[model samples]
Target: MSEHQPLSVDGQPQQLNQDEATQLAEELKQQIRNGVIPAGDSDSIERMVAGLGDPRGLMRLTFAESLGVVGKAAVPSLCRALSEHDSVTVRRAAAKTLTLIEDPRALPVLLKALLNDPDPVVQGSAVGAMAAVGAEAIDGLLEVLINPNSTAMQLGLASWGLAFVGARAPEALRNAATSDHAEIRCAAIAALGDQIQSLDDSEARGLVEQGLKDSDRDVRAEAATLLGKLHNPAWAAPLLEPMLNDPEGQVRKNAALSLMKLQATASRPALDVRLSQEDQTDVQAVLKLAINQLDQAG
Candidate 1:
């Protein structure tokens, strides 16, 4: 390979030997810093995108950051490479690069990669991009959450996206909280925790109350965990107190831990009662801890 390989020609990736790639990547970074190709200069942009495939980890990161600086002008090419690149390395880099750019135009490509990419890293990068895109990407994330065909990994990523953007999408989170799928409900409830924390939104808090009663034990446990993070004993403590006797031991345990987090001294009596009757050794330990913590707080 040449000592100084040219970037991709006509948007086609050309193989570059490691040394040539390093030199070319540094040159491109300099050009980007000097504002050479930010106007979507086709050749320069394609070269920058191609640099995402650099075999050197540091070079690849440098190229991704530079492409991010190129901003919206780089979205189209990045999207194409993310969806079509034969190299998983290129595809992964492209998705991660879009996360820094955070242009809404890349959401479609990111969503497709999240759902269809064979590589887990590529799929996760797509989720990160959608999250960075913020509110505009909420509906798409919710769509994945509700789709029965969505894999556990995909569902997990989409749920993460929802939590990340929850404050910006309260209405969407509310709708998702009522979803037929337990997984969707669990995700929505968790995201609502974000909404409650960020906005102190009353409606989001109400939905979390519903989550505590969800048919799925996991969802109920998730709801119990969400309440502990709210830091509002007046509201959260009352909600969690009743959960001490929940049929599910995990739910009861989470309720005790949450009460501990709240320092809900008022709930110590309830904790004391549960501790004596608690059959599960783990729940008993958690109840004792909550009571002890509350006693110390008082």
Candidate 2:
């Protein structure tokens, strides 16, 4: 009986004042907590859907703005609209709203939307939303990564999700570093580095070697960068030749930086070989760092 103004069948305004917006937002919240967040006896969602058709787009934005203002209480209803409503804009807004609220429940559906939603805008919106959902949603995020239907294309989002969850996502990441998809491998490798400041020699050395040889220049470069963050000297040898010899200048540079990270003077000879022999100016930068490191260590 609370005033939400009234749903117009034709094209007229519901005249939603402050009291009305609050009433609508609260009822939507209760129905969601009760798990009855569908159209309900009042068919509230259908009205919102029709509001999406408003010529000015004002009413729709108002609904979205109000739901976002209501915070966690509106999560279930926003999720319901995201899933069941035809308007992708509404769904996108709902995703943004969930980000503000940081609702754990919305994480699964946002994961679904990130991977499965036909709309690209919704896909990116879901990515941002899942990121906001934070650590508790990480298990669901990893499940998406392991699923065959999930993809390397979405690996950036998966990486972000893993970072949000930190160490909790490590097991899945260790497996993904060797995934066939180049982007997934790169993302997984980069994600592991972000999650862990240092990897044991066994954990990183072989992966570093394999990744240094990755077919994609960007992947190889990222692997080299991640290896740089590892403090172990064993990675120095594996990373040495790549610093001066890799086809990509950035990869070689990162390898040089990583070798220095190991604080090894032994890297000098290999770097001198690259500087004297390699053509890229960027690679020369790496060669100079090696000489500098050698001087310091001596």
Candidate 3:
């Protein structure tokens, strides 16, 4: 078949025979491996891959992998496909390709797709791509997290992305911790705790303390859980101890669990007091467990 002639398989376009498609893919891979796409030649390669007529999506995946092999050189065309392509399959393939390339230039289009893509798979791919860009993607991810228009799922994905964006992310997290928007603040605090290993004790403590005092019960509960993950004895008294008295049962339970994780012997007295007055059976059980853990440690 002529390279330009569109072949049909099950009524879907199949531009090249299997052998021809494979040969073209291999050639692109070799060129990519060699770090040369002959300058301005990437557009041609992208066009060829985008034209592949595989109905089952296997050929599209194969070609997308080849685009990934092409690396930064393929970014411009891939970004185009991600933003301008009419086919969701092609757009999704482009997003995957950009993720493999991990070029920061793809950030704008990737962020756009993450927020607006009608396809969940495409939005997820954009999230993965943002993560693949690492530190460079932090600002854009933060923008998404802070946007009131962002969906709960988008905020969750952006928060997850921030956790993977390296040490620079904490600065954004710090800002988000105090956002007027409760969801942003909650997500930021949760992300801050997730990266506690990368933070200094003071930074972690300050952020978690802020969360524990938040008016929102969800933020307080998340903070209590984060403190447990940190396992810092320093937080047991000023932080976890007071949380045992929080009106929110979930917060009290999390605080007790955190105290247990820290093995805070000092919290034993407070745990005893909480257990005597705790109305929720679950919170009381956790308080008893905290007391038991402290006893064992002592």
Per-residue lDDT value at 132 in model 3: 87
- Tell me the tens digit of each residue's lDDT in model 3 across 1-298: 0112221112122245667666666666677678765334644555554543344466666677766655677776777667766678777877877888887777888888999998888888898898887666877887887788999788888888776664555565676678787766776777775567655646766877878899999899988888787656784456788998999999998888888888888778888988998788887778888888889999
Ranking by lDDT: 1, 3, 2
Please provide TM-scores, in order, for all candidate models, with all chains considered together: 0.81, 0.56, 0.76
Error of 1 at 152 (Å): 4.8
Model 3 vs. true fold: TM: 0.76
Q: Is candidate 1 or candidate 2 better by TM-score?
A: 1
State candidate 1's TM-score: 0.81
lDDT of each: 0.84, 0.63, 0.74
Instruction: Please state every model's RMSD to the true fold in angstroms.
Output: 6.5, 9.1, 7.4
What local lDDT does model 2 show for residue 70? 50
Candidate 2 segments exceeding 4 Å error: 1-16, 22-76, 83-93, 96-125, 131-158, 198-206, 213-216, 232-238, 241-243, 247-250, 260-266, 289-298
